[model samples]
Structures are given as structure tokens and as C-alpha cells.
Target: MKKESRQKESLGRILKYMKKYWLFLGLSIALAVISVILTLYIPILTGDAIDYIVDKGKVDFTYITPILKKMVVVILITAAAQWIMNVCNNKMTYNIVRDIRKDAIRKIEILPLKYLDAHSYGEIVSRVIADVDQFADGLLMGFTQLFTGVVTIIGTLGFMLSVNVKITAVVVFLTPLSFVVAGFIAKKTFSMFKLQSETRGEQTALIDEMIGNQKIVQAFSHEDEALESFDEINERLEKYSLRALFFSSITNPSTRFINALVYAGVGVFGAVSAIHGGISVGQLSCFLSYANQYTKPFNEISGVVTELQNALACAARVFELIDEEAQVPDAEDAVVLEEVKGDVDLEHVYFSYEPGQKLIEDFNLHVNPGERVAIVGPTGCGKTTLINLLMRFYDVNSGTIRVSGVPVKDMTRSSLRSSYGMVLQETWLKEGTIRENICMGKPDATDEEMMEAAKASHAHNFIKRLPKGYDTVIAEDGGNLSQGQKQLLCIARVMLCLPPMLILDEATSSIDTRTEMKIQEAFGRMMKGRTSFIVAHRLSTIEEADIILVMKDGHIIEQGNHEELLQKNGFYAALYNSQFAQS
Candidate 1:
């Protein structure tokens, strides 16, 4: 129910964009009314000609020519008016759809990082594409049909009553009876349609998951299993689609039958009234024409209503995404971090992904300006969590983290992030030239400056070896490059940013030892006069760090330079000897 209301709110919001085209809307309705009124004249002309022939012995141009000429005029006017309506309606639809898509995309951009982390990628994709499509049909197209249909129905019914009041009663009497059937079938069809959409969303999600993990599927030879799972989702979607189709099919035929019965009654009554001399030939003709206008509008309206329900379901999903709170709403008074000195401090910081399990408990660390710190621990000892907190990716639950002297939460996210350069254990490279990837770190950096940063990270030599050097094309995720090469490129990229602080999380773990030595030397150059945090399991990598902190199960158990930790014979020493310092 909340989802439904959200979708409705989205629809209402869309109207504001549409409200700009109010003139077009009014013009389209005006044209449709004129076209419908002109069309109603056709049936009147048909019946009037018949009545004239029956009342007189001979037919002459005087009696028939005027009606024929009037019909030609009506046809030309209707054709012109219809062309105008189609043009205006189409223009209106385009503008509305464009704005809606833009709003959805723009909102997605400001959505918090946590929201993106929480939701499945496939579900997000579906909301943007599949859900917005619903509003395209019902909200926009339905708006078009509704305005035109109401105008036509009203014009037709009014003409009918003015022509012969008594006969018009019979035609309208049948309308109320059809409503009962329309209401029942609309309810059933909507339920089935909703089921179909749910299944399709599931199927989309399954396919997205399978494709994203295609490497695992091929490695484990589980392609067939994946295919079977996909088929199950497909089958459910098909079943629901078929059920909706059946119920929707009931609506049109049922309306057609009701229309047929009403037409027959109107014809019989007209004949009897005319024969008794109570009505004229032209009068009955006009009455039937008016009745036709009413029935015709409803004839198509029933189908449109079913489609509206389907669109409504889609709208619900889209609004659900747009309504999600932003990932990081900026503080009203967030100060820009002009130039941070990279003095970082953490005090009594505690955090947990869930309530009961703390990932970091009372974690405290201080890195003065230009100091170099290395954090080492077991895999789950909150190594990465510390980095994440420092980056302000997640705010602490019970403590304060400061950059310089200000709490991180008080700084705008963009400003806080701009002060640090980070190279993760895993690296990513967009499919582009090496130069483009590096320059992305500092969009406005000079070419000489970028190359200098790359040189400092030891990436310049490898880049020079490529055929086109910096222009060499990398495959998606830089798959063509070795893991170490990608890591080196990421290193160069972050280094180019020249941020006040640098974080190298297992930065050298993937490279060959020989390359690690060269990169380490280059990293020493990169870290000069910059506060740096290095997280590594390799004890040899951190021996030169000014401060070495050892963590275990969310607590900082040991802190000192490497030589000091080795002397303590605690967790850090045991870990180093067992993994690195032993052999």
C-alpha cells in the first residue's frame, strides 16, 4: 500500500511537468470534440437520405445534395482537427516522458551510497526502465484518451437527447448494465497483470545475476543450472501474462455484446415510433447517430482501462526508487575543506553492520600531518572497515572521526573525499586509453603533471611499452592487462590526483616481488610530506612505516613501529612470523 501511494505521488509530481503543455492539452480536447461532433453527422446524413427517399416517390439533387455537401465539409474539418490533435498529443507525450526520465536519473545520482549498496542492481535497472514505461502508457496516454473520450461521449449523448428524448433513454439504460461487467473484469485483469509484472521483474533480476557471475558459471561448469533457474522465472511470467490476457479479452467482447443489444433495441423502437407518425425520419436518424457516438467512446475505453491498471503497477515501482532517501544528504552548513593538512584522528570509534556484532570497537588512531602509518591485521580484523570509516563511506555509531580539526560528518562528502587518494586491493579501469584513466584522477591536470604522477607510481615505464603508449586501448575492466598492471594503473590514477592524503590498501600485494620493490621505492617518493595509511599482510612492506598498528577482531591490540611490535611477541609478531618473518 505504501508503494502504491508512492507511485501515485510520482504521478501527481509528473503533472507539474505536463502542466506546462496546458494549452496543447486544451487544444487537443477542443479538436477531438469537433472531430467527434462532425463524425456524428455521418450517421445522421445516412438516415436522413433514407427517410427522404421513403417519404417521396422520386429522388432529386435538391433533397440529397445539401447533406452530401455538408458531409464533405464535415470530413475536411474532422480530418484537419484530428491531424492537429495527434500532433499536439504526441508533442505533449514527448515532453512529459523526457522530464520524467530526467527526474528519475537525476534522483538516482544523489541517492546515498548506502542505498545503492542495499539494493540489487537489476531491481534498480528495472525501476528506471520498466517502471517508468508504465507511466508512459497510463499516465500520459491515458490522459490523452481520457480527455478525448469524455468530450466525445458528452457531445454524442447530448445530441442524442436533443434529437429524440424517449429513444435516447433506451440507449443509456444499457450503459449502466455494462458497467457492472466492466468493474468486475477490470479488477480481475489488474490482479493478473500485477502478477505478470512481478514475475518479469524476478526474471530480469535472475538474468542480471547470472550474467554478472558468468565467470563463476564457466569456472564451475554450472551453465546448465543457471539456465534451469532462468527458465523457472520465465515460466512464472508467462503464466501470469496469459491469465491477464484472458481476463482482458473478456472486457471487449462483453462491451461489444451490450452495444449490439442496445443498437437492436434502438432500431426497433425508432421504426415503431416513425410508423406511428410520432417521430420524423430525420429525427430518428439524428438520435441513432448520437447513440453511436456514446457507444463508440465506451467501446475503446474498456481496453484502455485495462492498460491503465498495468501502467499503474509499473508507476508504483518507479516511484519506490525515486522516493528512497538520498545516500548522503549534504548538511545545510557543510564547510568546504579548502586544503586539509591530512592530520587524521579517531576517538572511541565503534561500528557494526548489524546490531550485535561490532566490526570496530573503541577503535582509536592518530596520524599527525605528514606521518606514515601501516595497519596490519587478520582478514576480518576491521582493516578495510577502518579505511571505509576514514573515507566517510560510513559514519561511526559512537565516536568521532576528524580530518584536521573538523568532524567528517560536518564536511560535504565531495569536499572530504577530494582530500584523499585511495587505491583499493581490487582495481577498476574503464575501457579507455591509459592516459584517459590517469587524467580522470585530475580532470584539469596538465599532461606533464599526469605523467609525473604516473612516474612516481612506476606506471610510466609500462605505459611507455604499449604500442600507442598512453593511448593504448584497454579491455573492459582492463582485462587484457595483468592484475598487477591494472593495480599499477590504479596507483598512477590516484597518485595523479595529488590529494593531501594517500591510502594504499594491500597496494603491493598483487605485484611480483621484483616489481613490488620498484613500486615500493616509487611509493616512498609518493608518500613524502603526505600523510599515508598502508594496510598490508606482508610484514616486509610496513617495516619502514613511522607507526604500525595491529588489529584483532575489531580491537587495536598492538601499536608501535615494526621493530617494536616484533619485540612485543604479541598478535602482530606471531602473525608476522607465521606468515612473513618466519621463513
Candidate 2:
């Protein structure tokens, strides 16, 4: 029952998308009606021409010629109407698909970061691209075949009833059987097709994961395991796909079998009626054509049912994505922060990715304006989680985080986040020229300003050596550039913006020591008057921080200037000594 409801809801939403193209839809329907009517009239003209032939010698060419000419004109008009109807259908189907894609992309943009963090990138891509393509195929088939099939069925039934009530009754009687068989098979196939779509998404995700990290798989000698996992997913996808197709394929043949019965019933009864002088031989010929036409739609409709099932399944998945809860909108009175003074405060904060995990609890911090604070902690100690909360990527479960003395929640997320310049360990660079990448945070930045930021981040030298200098177009995710170069570009991006506050989370992890030192100097200059939060594992890199925060298991174990913490010989001293000892 729930599955049926969901299918109806998905179909309803698709219709809503089509509502904007009602004029085109109406035109297509009108054309389909004209085409079917003209097509049905052709059989009558054919029967008339047949009656005109009497014993072959008494045939009247003048009368028969006009009927034949009328049939030709009807066929031509039918063909033209069908062609025009198809054009409208194609336009509407593609336009709806385009709108669906656009909505999916817009939803992705506003979706909470937590949602993205939980879902695999490849699965999302499949929903937006592969599933949508499948939906388009189904919609197009429905528009082209289903509409005409329905009109043909109704038109043929009316024509048959006018000629002979008994014959038309036989066709209607057998017609219900076709619907019964199709409905039974369709109910079974919907679940199979839904499973098939889900499994296909899993396979796509697995393949994407393996291909994107092939270097790691080879380095770890895990090719056999990767292939094994992929084979498992591939086999499941094949199983579901085959099962779905098998059930859907049954609908067509089963309906065809019932339709043949209807056709046979008409032939047997119409012949008897003619032998009894109840109808002329020409009328029997016309009735036979109407019977074939009436049953043909049943067969076509069954095929359409199969396609619509698959399309509905894909559409359900896409709508599920679009319907996901978006990030809470900024309050109506939310104020945009301007002229940020860089004072940050976190009071009694608590957060966890999952409930009952209690990752971070009662965390408190206060930074004076323009202070440089560094955070050092072991893995899984909520170091990165802290940055996530500060940037509003994930809201704290309890308590408040304030920037410049205003609660973060009270400020527009865009305005609050725009105040911070972040350079993280995992650098992300879109496929674009070096100049475009560096100027991403400030698209309209002057060339001199961009070059200065690049030189400050020690990326200018490398940029100048590139084949196209700053115009060098990198591959997606900066795949063509070395990790260090990508990191430098990310730093240059932050430098170009020069936000009032900074978050440097292992910002130089990818760079060599020499370049790291130069970047550190650049960072020192940039951090001079900005409130900066630095999260790093290397204790040596943050020794000059105005304050060093030692964290453990989501608690602030110690907090003081580097010298003060070193003198106290607490967790901070132990972490610092361990790093240098390892070196």
C-alpha cells in the first residue's frame, strides 16, 4: 500500500512539472485525437471500396476511385497529425527532464553539509544523471505510445459498437483480461525495478570509488579485494535488472495473447452474423479491422505500462533526493555581519555527528580580537568537528557560538562564513585555470592583487613556470597538479580574499619543509591582525601562537600560551615532546 502511494505521489509530482507545458500537452492531445479519428475512418473507406467491387466486371471505377482517393487523403492527414503530436511530446518530455535536473542541482546546493557527508558522491551523481536519463526515456515512451494507444482504443471501440453491438461486446469482455494480466505483472515489476535502480546506483558508486582511488588500491595491493567488491555489486545489479525485465516483458505477451482472443471472437461472431443476413460482407470487413485496432491498443498499452513502471521508479529516487531536508534558512531578522572585529567565543558548546555518541561536550572558548590560537589534539578528538561547527557546516547540538560578540545562529550563515578565510589539508580545486582558482574567493580581483596573493603564498613561482602561466587549465579536482601545488593554490585563494578571521587546519601538510617555512612566514604576515584558529598535528609549526589549546576526547585539557603550557608540563607539553621525539 505504501509503495502504491509513493508511486502515485511521484507520478503526481511529474504531472505538476508538466502543468507548465499544458498548452503543448493540449495541442498534442488534440493532434493525437485527430490522427486516431482519421486512422479509424480509413477502415470504413476501405470497406466501402470493397463493397464497390461486385463480381469484378460490374465494378464502378469512378465510385471506387473517389473512395480510394479519400482513404489516401485520410492517411496523409493522420501521418501529419502524428508527426506534429510527436514533436510536442518530445519538447514537453525533454523540458520536464531539464527542469528536474535543475531542481536536483538546486537542492544539492542548499542541502545540509551533513547530508552530503553521509551520502556517497557517486550515488548522488547517479540520481542526477543516470536516473534522470532513465526517467526521460520512460516519459517519452508514455507521451508517444501511451497517448495514442488510449485514443486508438476508445476510437476503435466506438466504431465497432456502431457497426455491431454483439461483436463490440466480445472485444470489451476479453479486454478486461488484458488489463488484469498487465496489472498483476506491473505490481510485481515495480519493486523489482526500484531495486534495480538502487543497485545500479551502488554499482556506480563502487566503480567511482575504485577508479578515483586506483593509486591507493594498487599501493595497498588490494586490487583483488576491489574487484571482488565490484563483482558482488555488479552481480546484484544484474540479478535485479533481469528479474525486473522478466516480469515487465511478461505484460506485453500476456496482453497480446488476450488481444488475439478478442480478435478471434470478433471473427467467429462477425462471420455468423453475416451468414444470417444480419450485416453485409463489407461491414464484416470493417468490423474485423475495428476489432484488430481495438485489441492492438491493449497490447501497446501493456508495453507502455512496463516503460511507465521503470520511469516511475527512477522518478521516485530523484524526487527523494530533491525532497531531502535543506539547511535551515536564516531567520527573518538575521543580520549580515560587516566590519567583523574577529572576536570569537564559544560557550558551553556540545555536538556529535550521531546521537548518543557525545563527541564534543561543554566545550568553551574565548579569543580576544586579533589573537592567534592553535589547537592540537590526537585523532578523533573533535579537532575538525570544531572547525565544522565554527564554519556553520554543522550546527552545534547545544549552546552558542558567537563571532564578534554575536551568536552565530543570529547572523546570516553566508555573512558569518564569509568572514573567515580557510585553508585545509584536503585541498579542493575545480577544473579551471590557475588564475580562476586563485581568484575564486574574489572573482573580480585585479591581476596585480591576485599575483600578490599568489606570491605571498609562494605559488607565484610555480604559476609562472606553467605552460600557460596563470591561465593553465587543470583537470577536475586538480588531478593534473601535484598535491603540494594544489595546497599552494588553495592558500593563494584564501590569501586573495583576506577575510577578517582565518582557519588553518593542517594548511601546510602537503608542502615540503622549505616551502612550508615560507608559507608559514606568509601566514604569519596574514595572521598579524586577524583572529586565526589553527589546528595542526605538528607542534613545531604552532609554537609562536598567542595561545595553544590542548584537547582530548572533546574536552579542553589545557589552554595557555606555548611557553606557559610548556612550563606547566601538561598534555600540551607531552604532545609537543612526542612529535619532536618522533622526528
Best by TM-score: 2
Q: lDDT values of the candidates?
A: 0.82, 0.92
- Tell me the spans in candidate 1 whose CA falls farther than 4 Å from its real position: 1-17, 45-59, 62-69, 278-289, 431-435, 455-476, 479-485, 581-583
Tens-digit lDDT track of model 1 for 1-583: 6644644665576677779999988898888888878887787787777666754567766888888888898899989988888888888877877776777898888886667777778878877777667657665567667767778778777777767888888988888867787778877776677677777777777788888778889999999988899888888888899999988888889988887788888889998999999788777776666666677666677777777777767765666666777666779999899989889999999998678976888888888999999998888989898888998887788899999999998889898888889998888889888888988868898889888987887788888999999889887788678888899889888878878999999988779999899889988888999999999988888899999988889998899998899899988888888876436
Task: Show the colliding residue pairs in model 2.
Answer: none
lDDT of 2 by residue, 195-230 (tens): 999998988888899899989999999999999998
Badly placed stretches (over 4 Å) of model 2 are 56-59
Worst 10 residues of 2 by lDDT: 574-583
lDDT of 1: 0.82
Question: What are the root-mean-square deviations of the candidates from the true structure over C-alphas?
Answer: 3.1, 1.5
